[model samples]
Target chain A: MLTKRIIPCLDIKDGRTVKGTNFVSLKDAGDPVELARLYSEQGADELVFLDITATHDRRKTFAELVEKIAREISIPFTVGGGISTVEDVQVLLKAGADKVSVNTAAVKEPELIRTLAEKFGSQCIVLAIDANLVNSEWKVFTTGGRHATDINLFDWAKQGEALGAGEILFTAMTRDGTKDGFDLEANKRLSESLRIPIIASGGAGNMNHFTEVFQQANVDAALAASVFHYGAIGIQELKKELQRQKINVRI
Target chain B: MSNRKINIAIIDYGAGNVKSVQFALERIGFSGVLTDDITTIEQADKVIFPGVGEARSAMQALKDKGLDTEIPNLKQDVLGICLGMQLMCDYSEEGGTEGMGIFPGKAKKFPVPLKIPHVGWNQISKLKTELFQQVNEASFGYFVHSFYVPLSEWTVAQTDYSFPFSAALAKDNFYGCQFHPEKSSLVGEQILRNFLAL
Candidate 1:
């Protein structure tokens, strides 16, 4: 049976994890590689590293980070942010990433999804959609949620799947960084519609939020940043709770 | 069990996540060269065939790189991952394509009422080979595939998604698995290390 996955996202800038990450593990957790190892030990099914720095120099640093992280951990690693071309995907993959998540570029060039799928296989392609509630309708956002597009959330998700995107990661802009909970209604719509796996991202406040998303939205995976990174919720503790609730976690 | 260096070549058909496989090797203290260079593959102590594309195109890729003819004859220990495992079989129902026939069997799509691509971590049991050394019975492995090889004589391990299917196949020096050992975490690393030891 396909069990639901719990993934912790590490937002990286200049090869370092950002967003209030304490300097506790300079020897073990301060470094992105060490932090990834810690998460793996905590029973994270997969890990996502979002490259917040888009500069050329940072790209090189990010590649190096990918290598270091891969050498340390054996779980599936996905690198995203500022990835706009096939070359970008190739660079990250060559550096040891298992998958590359596309967002802004995917919105601009829908065909980019098909090309990536054909060249690298759909399994390696993840379409990350940042959706904002515009006039009560979910609209796609770009440039880190500063702008909205005409692309409707449902239409774009199905198109992405048809275009060969193996997985869809939907981040609810309305709830991003709010620490409230996942947008259950939005997640439910996408999960029920898509044949492929759906990853529910953004607005994870506490342990109950994860349990709710898994139970109500039926997301194949739940991704959180601060809850995991800031240690607001320990991955092992959350997974153990989910298992106790009969959530069928890897733990 | 001296730590003498082993030359490993990862057969790259311009497909699959070969870098992940290479990194997995490096984690276990082995460095693998990712190349389609026929000589590099031929001379290596071991070869790992990795793939993610469909059967017909994957077959075409191997043929274009002259691997279709060379792989079946290699005397060194060879391992196949995901689509690579499927292609090592006799035939595949996908695109009605023929495989390398290294192990006589066929890969087919999962039937109805079941998810198409069996994605995520699932357990494998009935270990029939030593390549599973250090791996616990019913240990989970990362898998992402739309097609799977039906149970056959060459199958060494089985996993249940909707029903029982061949998770790993072994015959002589050739080994194949539908799961990505590189993405399967520690137990997966153990399996890869065991393969390298062989």
Candidate 2:
């Protein structure tokens, strides 16, 4: 049976792990490579590294950080933030990143998704959408959820699938940093609508929240940052809780 | 050319991503080339058929290049990955297409309520052949597809989804895996390494 995955996302800036509230007011956490190794030991199904800083100085450091993390970890890892061309995807995959997450670049040029998928295979491409509910409609946001696009969440997901994206990582900006719970309603709608596997991100306070997302939304995986980073919830305890709830999880 | 460098030709029938397959082979210290030329493909020490699209379309692409017949006639050891493996079967229910008929089975859809595409990693047990000699029965590999080949004598390994399904098939000179070894991490790499040693 296919088990629901538990992923801990690491936000990297200047070669160090950082966490912020509502995606702002960043504070240094620790070394990216050490943190990645720890997560792998703790039974993380996968890891996501997002380069929070878009500056020129930070870009070089991000590549170095990715190389270092790739050397230390054995599991599959995804690198996102500022990926724009097919060559970029190639370079990252060559550097040992299993998948590349595309956001603003994919939205601007939807054909890039097809091109990258064609060259590297759909399984290597992940379409990350940051959406926020505005006036009861989910609107797509990009550039780390600072800019809103005209594309609707549901329609964009279908388009991404058609473009050969292997999986969709949907992040609810409205619920991010809230710790209330996952946006179950949004995740449920997306899961029912998309043919590909969906990973629910944002708003996970405790183990039960993970259970609610998996049971209510039926997502393939749940992704969280602060909850796991701030020592609020351990990955093992959460998986145990999910297993107790009869959700299929790999021990 | 000495036998030390075993040139592995990966058939590119315009069906799937060939780079990752090439990358995996190279990562395992094996010489691999992606080509559609008949002479180069036939002359290679080993051959790999990798596909990722619809069965009918992939067969059409192979037929257009006349590789539909050339592939089955190859005397060298050949391995098929994912859709490539399905194309080696007698036929596929996907897009109402017939395959190369290298194996005696038909690929069909999984029972409903189990989802169409059986995506993600699952464990393989009841293994056979030296290809899986070092790999444990509990080893897991990544998979993503809607259709699967039914159990038969050719099936050397089995994985459970809605039920226990064929994970690896072997017959004569042909070998096939429904899962993608290139994306399946260390265990997948071991499978490829074993194939190379064969």
Candidate 3:
């Protein structure tokens, strides 16, 4: 049986982890590689590093950080944020990052998905969509969920799959940072609509939320940042609970 | 044990990233040279064929570099990962590709209603080869692929997604894994260590 994945997403700024991760074992909480190694050791199925750096040297620093993480951490990891061109993805993959996720750039140029998928197999290209419900419709948002687009969430996800996206990282902007729970309704609809695997992101408060996202929404994976970074829930404990509930988890 | 002298060659035909595999070897204290040269690969102590991409084009890339013919002829122990594993089979339904015929099976796409890529962590059970040395039964392995090689005598391990499929295949000097061992954490590192030990 394929286990439901638990992913810890870290926000990277200038190649270093921005948030103060609350892992007591960690020597330097600001080091992305240290946090990534800790998560991998804790049975994290995969990791995502979302680079929030805005400087021109973002590429060099992020690539170096990726190289360090790849050398140190054995678990698979994905890099995202400001990924717009083929060269950007090429550099990351070359640096040993297993996969790269594209959100805003993909929305701006839908062909970028096809190009990246064609160049670096669909398995390594994840299409991340930030969605918000407005007037009973899930509208797609870009530029870190700041700008709204008229694109329908389902339509865009379906198109992304057709364009050769291997997986969809659907993040509900409204549910994000709320820690209430995932947007089960929207995620369930999206998971059922797309042939690719759906990773439900945002609104993960506790172990129940992870279980609910898996059982109710039938998502392949659940991704959260704060709950994991702040030590609100431990990965091993969460997986054990999921296992007890008969939800298959890699323990 | 990995510090011992061994010529490791990771065949690079521009199909996909081999850096992860190289880095994984580094973690285990081994360095692999990335080369498409037949002589270099043929002379290596162990060969790692890693790839990710469309089957037809990957096959084309292999042929362009003349690795398509040389890969099978190598007398050294060879291991293929992911698409490299798929391409070692007799055929693949993806792009209707005819494989290198090193292994006796065909790769087919998973049936509909199941997720396409079969991504994330899954367990590999019924281990039958030394490649899984010291690895527990039904241990999880990270996988990301749309197509899978059906179970056959060459199957060393099996994983269930839509159904039982070849997680690892072994025959003679060639071994293949559908999952990325370099990215599968400790279990994967052990698998690589076992392979290098061979």
Candidate 4:
């Protein structure tokens, strides 16, 4: 059987790896290529580069960084953030990203998913949903978690699948940067409700948290930033622990 | 002529993932060129067809570039990945697309009862080809597709998803894998190495 994937997402700003708390109060991590190569060697199944660069010229720099990282790493990797057009997906994929994730873009222009899927195939089109708990329901938040849309998380995920999205990357804002572990209940619901693979993102404090998401939530993959970015946990050690727990992780 | 070294050409049919495939080859210490040129493909020591697109349109692109006819008649080692593997089949139910017929089989979408596009890694058992040289039976490869080639004489490997399907196919010098070897990490690179050795 295929093992659950452990993905370490890197937020790139001005071509450098950065870490933000709840998507704020950013801190410098390291060089993107150096960090990416280290994680891949440390037994990461895949890597995600979130282009958090706020400027136009910096986005181009991020593309070059993706190419450099692609040359350095052999495993599959995804590039996300600020991807709002077919041409944007094209530039990144041509730069050597195995996959591209679209969040706000897909929400703003749902047809963009179809356009990308038609051109690049649905297998590579990942729909990233950033959501937060609103009242009693999980609501989708867009614009980098600054704006909560009227879209419901569960409903939007299903709609994304219907829109030819191959995968759903669901990030729960409440648990994000809280270090209280993943929003397991929400992740579990999403995983159970959707037939497509669900990649649980945010709120990973330790290796056991990873195992918990994989075991309890039945997530196909888990993405963490700070736990991996700050070197708080080594990917190889985490995979080893997952193996000891009998959870299949790509080691 | 500085041509003594082996050259691998990845057939580009306007579909994507060719760069990633070439990168994988380079990462494995083998340089691969992405070209739709007939001369480049025919002369290379090995040819790779990495496909990631819709069936009808992808086949149309292959046909537009004349690779549709060129690929089926290749005498050298030819390895097809994912949709590349399916395009070698007799036909595909996806938009009722016709394949190169190098392998005697048809590719079809999973039934509605099962989830479409059997994505993610799964086990490959019942291995038969030299492609499985050092690759174990329990080894997994990353797969992402809604359509799958049915089991046939060309099937050298089998994987269960919805039901038993052709995970890998081999016929004469033509070979195909229904998974993404370029994206499948170490196990995948190992499979590519086995193909190179063959």
Give the best candidate by lDDT: 3
Model 4: CA > 4 A from native: A20-29, B1-4, B112-116
TM-score of model 4 vs. true structure: 0.93
RMSD of each: 1.9, 5.3, 1.1, 3.4
Better of 2 and 3 by lDDT: 3
For model 1, what is the alpha-carbon lDDT of residue A73?
87
Expressed as tens digits, the lDDT of each residue in A148-228 for candidate 3 is: 999999999999999989899999999999999999999999988888989999899989999998999999999999999
Q: Sorted on DockQ, highest at the top, how do the candidates line up? A: 3, 1, 4, 2
* Candidate 1 ranges beyond 4 A from true positions: A26-30
DockQ of 2: 0.18
lDDT of 1 by residue, A35-89 (tens): 8888898899999999998676987899899988877888998899988888988
Per-residue lDDT of model 2, residues B34-69, tens digit only: 899999999998899987767887888899999989
**Model 4 clash pairs?**
none
Winner by lDDT between candidate 4 and candidate 2: 4
TM-score of B-chain for each predicted structure, in order: 0.97, 0.97, 0.98, 0.96
Q: What's model 2's lDDT at A44?
A: 81
Against the true two-chain complex, what DockQ does each candidate achieve?
Answer: 0.63, 0.18, 0.84, 0.54
How well docked is model 4, in DockQ terms? Answer: 0.54
Best by DockQ: 3
- Clashing residue pairs in candidate 2, if any? none
Ranking by TM-score: 3, 1, 4, 2
Better of 3 and 4 by lDDT: 3
